[model samples]
Target: MPDHAILTADAHRDLRVNTERSAASGDAVMSAMVVPDELRQVQNEYPILFRRNLEHDRFTALAMFGFEDGENLFLEGTRWAARYLPLSIAIQPFLIGRPEGADTGVRQVHIDLASPRLGSEGLRIFEEDGSPSPYFHAVVEKLGMLDAGYQASIGFLAALRRHDLLEPLSLEVPLADGSTHRLVGFHVIDEERLRALDPAAVAELHQAGHLMPIFMALASLANIGALVARKNQRLRHG
Candidate 1:
């Protein structure tokens, strides 16, 4: 028997590698101001939400997304929130400011579940429950997925499934241009926040006694640890 079996037939999983972004140089975009009215445009290119106070094992903490104009600027965990979301892609070892290496530098793997070919139920799950997920507002309302956050989440999740991993513990996200999306068909969520949000729902899945979640979580972490090692090595020699 495999260590991690599929929690649901639609779970997503994958391995990715990338180096972190470059450091602040002569005149980097230190900060920018954004307003609720401008959120749509800003998130278009920078889909992932992040804040200065929150620290993901592999992200820089800074208030870069929101507005400095004083009308709800994104402050990350304090304002913009992000974490090791449940998906199925491994994006890490990104080279921003540091020299690149072979799986040598830290890699950020994005794990998610998404597919253009999904059922109605699948799509509903994602929108109903997801963090930093303003994407849902329009979804359930039968409005539209014109929101950037919603679209990014959907595309990112679907991309994961296209990559191979099954989607589990899913949610439905919207896409730009007013399109509904069944992001992760299902994904293993092992975060405290998730647990806190929906213990009953998770418990139901656990009762099924599937190790898929554990495997998914560990797989992502193992990949991260490997990249961290390479990063540490480079820093040590430098």
Candidate 2:
């Protein structure tokens, strides 16, 4: 369980968070939830796929880093090997919260005291004068982006569904060790359907600001081959 508390300079003046990229710092993962806002950058490094949330009965995007659980091929030693990281991965141990009985529109910064990244070293959250440090501000910016993206995604996904542009994706990935991994329960943009759409439909998607993200998600599939190469290289070196 997480011990979440509203972040306050007076309560946590000396708090420092480990910014290192490592499994010990909780960076190891097969995938990270992503939003359409970051798809332009995320497409360059990860395969963007959509996942269905049964409980919510909605779709969400994910940036895949590996084919299996607990595996992150992007991690090379203590450093991440990508030029752009998903906002969901960059913002850790910090989340936006609202005060109980207050307006739900109000956003406040909250910190998890039990996170492994919280330690005596690394980036400081606040200065001695009780002001937010540069690192803290950067994190808040990411959290804001993530929050806005999450809200935008509700509309983006609905547009895709309305257009019948999403389809199930099943992949059989073969590695150097003669083993095959089957990827299931993931969806991708149906390029065929997208291309077959009428001009009015295309205009609607473009006007709604969803066309580019759909194209970016299609482009991201190219990275799957590179991700497989990384897994093969890791296998060879090990």
Candidate 3:
């Protein structure tokens, strides 16, 4: 976002705790809260960004990239950790039945989002050395990418709407360790009304021409209530 069109605030309520790093950085983790009372008055002053899972119908997420429990991904200065609905079907090529230590680099190129040229071929390295870590492999074997994008969009909306953007909400998570974290934050997204962002941003993104293939593929994949599977698969989220 451009500096002129942005507002910065401190928050800690909903950021998801990264157990992987939390072990070492738990004491370093800081938190903030999005002031709801401050939001109601300024809600209309900015464009509202509504978010929804291209796959799941129940809750919608903002478009910001960061932890669900914390303020900004920049705080940790690492790759983002997020979830989405359509991602299950979108990333099947590299995630399914593949060995460990695999990286497709699908996200490295800007155009990759709208093209079919995804990650490097091969399995990813399994980082198990008898030590249980907090970092878990977030695989869809299916997809949650598009929903992630949608979620980010929602985040943008919230940031624009109120000075306080990050707030805690409930997430019905099923952890691998058989232990559940209650009251996980899933930021708010107004499913119905969202301001239309600058079309120029998308136009500039695709101006390169090479990135066309992936979004073209995504266009077909993102459909409402769309369900697609591997081999015998079909598109689900719209």
Candidate 4:
């Protein structure tokens, strides 16, 4: 359960967030939100896909970590097995929320006080003098980066929509125990459509810096094999 509250130095002076990778620390996740800026590096280790929100009619890019809910194949003991961690996962227990009566663009930091990661011991968020600590600064920086990345992603997503390049995807995996899992509700880049774009559109996309991420997202499909191998390894070891 989340007990979300505004993050303030006075109220959360003794609060700290655990950085370890474990279920108790809220690091056990199946997927994390991804942005265009991270597609190149994230595509190397995770499959990048788009998830649509039926209510809002919007699409969000995600980096798949596991085939099933509550399963994170990259988690190994107290450390994540991946060389790069998604910014969304790294910024756990902290979120950007709207301030009361504020307009749409107003964003404020909110903390999940009930998160298992919250404890008395860990990186201090505030010093004894009620000043932000180094850890706090780092978190703020990362949060800012996340905000900017999301803002920039709007243009990238619009570009994809304009070209009708998003296509539904279905994944089927055979496990070691002879059971197969079917994954759905995700979308991917349509490579054929992308390649078939008119030269003028291609040049426009290239000028907008969206071409690399499109290819990167398509390339991430190769990591699906690695994910399956990891799941099978876990099943055999268990």
On TM-score, the candidate that comes out on top is 2
Q: Each model's TM-score, in the order given? A: 0.19, 0.97, 0.19, 0.95
| Model 1's TM-score against the true structure | 0.19
The local distance difference test score of each candidate is 0.28, 0.93, 0.27, 0.90
Q: Residue-wise lDDT of candidate 1 within 115-189, one digit each (tens)?
A: 212233222223222321232223323212222233343343332233333323443433333543342312332
Model 4 misplaced stretches (Cα beyond 4 Å): 103-105
With candidate 2 superimposed using the best TM-score fit, by how many Å does residue 121's alpha carbon deviate from the native? 0.7
For model 2, how does the per-residue alpha-carbon lDDT over 53-167 read when each residue is reduced to its tens digit? 9899889899999998999999987999999989988998998888999997889999989889998898999999999999999999999999999989999999999999999
| Error of model 1, residue 181, in angstroms | 42
Model 3 error, position 106 (Å): 42
Clashes of each: 59, 0, 56, 0
* Best lDDT among the predictions, by candidate number: 2
Looking at candidate 3, what is the lDDT of residue 60?
35
Q: Model 4: per-residue lDDT, tens digit, 10-96?
A: 999988877888977887889999888888889989999999999998899999999989999999889899888888887778888
Candidate 3 ranges beyond 4 A from true positions: 1-159, 162-168, 195-238
Q: Name the lDDT of candidate 2.
A: 0.93
